[model samples]
Target: MTGAVESPFWTFVKQSVKSLFIVAFALSATSYTDDVVGSFEGLETGLSAALNTSTATTPKTTYEALDQSLGKGLDLIKICTENADAAGFNIGTAIGWLIAAAVIAFGTTLVTVIGGAVLIVSKFALAVMFAVGPLFIMLLLFPITARLFDSWFSQVLNFTLTIVILAVVMAMATTAYDAFIASVDLNSNSGESPMWAAVEIGALTGVLVWIILQISHMATGLAGGMSMAAMGIRHLMSPVTGGLSAARTAGNIINPVSTRRDLESGMMASGTRFDHMIAGNTVINPAYRQHVMQNIGKNWGWQKGGSVKN
Candidate 1:
């Protein structure tokens, strides 16, 4: 009688343990599936944010917007003798070649102009920033010069990325610059009429545009040349049959491809972040912002930056 009672008790204990393990395993699998899905979505969104997309009739969402439109608007009627991609890549390569070859002169000008900020610190980080930042800015922003003519120049030149970046920059800076100029006039205004002030400001704006145009053209042309040289070399090396395979393989390794639909997911994520901030649900960490501000101040300069500009 005692042995039979003990046997039944042991059997029930074993069944309970087995049931617990099955429940735990099921929960773990569900959690893992959810994690994998979230990771895939994160990567997809990041890519689209880097590129750009919009549904508005006017597509100028960044500083690149103005230049891109400027270039596209002008090229609306031009007929290319070649396929669009070929034309763009060739032009970009040619520009790059010319600029790379002539890197010393203009490159020096850019460095000296930009390095003025870091020269004050006269330290290692400052020195590196002073030297490398100018080169990057020149290589990157120089392509916007093509916008003086038409979007086709940038498209054919394949300078769209740079133009887009430039647009972002202008968007960030425009309001502050306009405010500063307004304040300056308010403080330093002569008894001169308001109309006269408007005329003078307008003239200044025109001059600035002209100066930017000159810079943009040279930069874009040089970038285009470089793009062409790269393509030309690739073409010369590969046989007609073997060439495309080699080329495509190289691109796959170099550029890495992605799809458009995934991009929208990221944009929506960023847009939501802004919404969160506006809603006051998300807080801006002051310490982190201050750190960023310090970096930018170093990059642009702090109080004495006025003298560095010209």
Candidate 2:
């Protein structure tokens, strides 16, 4: 016995059910789901606390962790700057070190604040995407709407990668700061200036800033590329839309009443003979061409055969 082919609706239903089951299983098996859900819940709680003129009691929230890390990094810079004299530096060298320290401190602050804000925003966006992911998956059930799902998935992936990159970069910068602090010998009496240490810190800060900028550029490029792809897909689908429009026009042409009414409307609405001909109100003949030339001559104050009127 031969098997029957499934209808499109049933096929879509089966695919949707299978996809949902797979997503449910994957979510249950992964810690990432918990992290996203927890972060969203934490955000809600934090907002509520702020609105009530209270403080959030949640420990190790994403923002709290970022603040703690940034604070420690700043503290390390403070120690280096504050104890510059303990390294047996002369007054001039000490002054130089302090200047460098000030610049490096400003750079560090800028990097940390911008990086932390990006990470926090990206994480929250990821959580939001996850919340609406099922709707996109359902959109994927139809070929006509699949591009919407693709665009959604691309954005979700971009946010995820951005968050991961920012987190890793921040962690590395923090570790580098801690290591630099540990390497400083404040008790040394060898008359060595801490100016070199200040230079190293400044260089590290510059490098960190460059890395963050590169990551931002990369994220923007990815989003821009996805947008271009989506536009291309829409361009490709234009023919389908045009075909539907053509079908409506054909239906109008096939009905005698509609055809007569459309011709009358076209003639009444047209501003020139060319417009009437183009709108199917009249046939394109020598008379229509001569009429167009005459109208153009009148509008431009010119005679036919390329002669201008005085």
Candidate 3:
């Protein structure tokens, strides 16, 4: 009886209905998968952009300031070298040693400056890698990026500090060498012999090198001490940091748009400054007047007409 009820048209219709159901399900699944993929891609793009912007505004400024300071130091060094005119030296060996010391000092400065520049660029690279790379996704599992960034920044700061110490040490050494050479009687008619001059130059170079190494060691020790102190402070502040992070997260969730806008405005305002050059004396923006007043507080005794209060 069941077999007798079957018709070719009805059977074809049944098969067509099954096919359409399958097609519908497949299309729906594909659309859902595409939506999920698109959402994830958008999230990654947004995180990458925000992280990159933070990096640009922070360490980039510090690096640029260091670059300018190092450039100025180099100019000062050049001026000092030019002023150190060796007027009485006739011995070839003595002159050669002075030239060698000058070259070494210059080379040392260049190497330190270049290394600092490279380190600055590496900071950006580190931020991008941690922000965008899937491998660093684990950082978000517990959000360790803040601590990591702080540690890296501290190390970079120590590196810059060491460079400054090195520059100061070199300047002192150069000055001392010039003074020592000036005191030496290099005249041919004087009692000093060429052999004695050679010995003096060798001894001076050795002393200078040793002094530089000692200063470098001292600077390294100081930097390490500072790093240890910073670590101790960070450890002490861990609970506070966690509390602040939770509060920030809750605030973001409550009013994300307003919170973000306020944060952006604050960052922009902090960096904005209007300068007016009046009679070669620069006057800063009035927006910062309150901050300056707060800092000066009781020490601010000036009247409205630029007269000091008695």
- For all candidates, what are the clash counts? 35, 0, 0
Ranking by TM-score: 2, 3, 1
- Name the candidate, 1 or 2, with the larger lDDT value: 2
- lDDT for position 190 in model 3: 54
Cα TM-score per model: 0.23, 0.48, 0.32
Highest TM-score among the candidates is held by which one?
2
Q: Write the per-residue lDDT of candidate 2 for residues 1-310, one digit (tens) a residue.
A: 1345456443444456555643563356354356534554454445434433222522233354356556755675565566556435466655765665676677678777777778777767887888776666556446687777677767765675565456556656666666766776533354444566667777887887788767766765766575545444334445654665676567546532222213433233523444445655444556545544555545565456865599
Q: lDDT of each model, Cα atoms only? A: 0.35, 0.58, 0.43
Q: Candidate 1 on 189-279: residue-level lDDT in tens?
A: 2332233333443443344344433434544565565644334312333364265566657765765533211121322223233343443
After superposition, which runs of candidate 3 have C-alpha atoms over 4 Å from their true positions? Answer: 1-147, 214-216, 227-310
lDDT of 1 at 15: 38
What digit string (tens of lDDT, one per residue) describes model 3 on residues 1-310? 4675567543444445544533443345464235523443444345333433342322223344345334533543343334234423544644543454455445435544544544454454434433333322222223345354344434433444444444444444444445645665544335444345445545654554555455435645665666544554245445755676687678657634311111213322221111122211122435445444545566566565665688
Question: Model 3: how far is 160 from its true place, Å?
Answer: 0.7
Least well predicted 10-residue stretch by lDDT in candidate 2: 257-266
Cα error, candidate 3, residue 214 (Å): 4.8
lDDT at position 50, candidate 3? 43
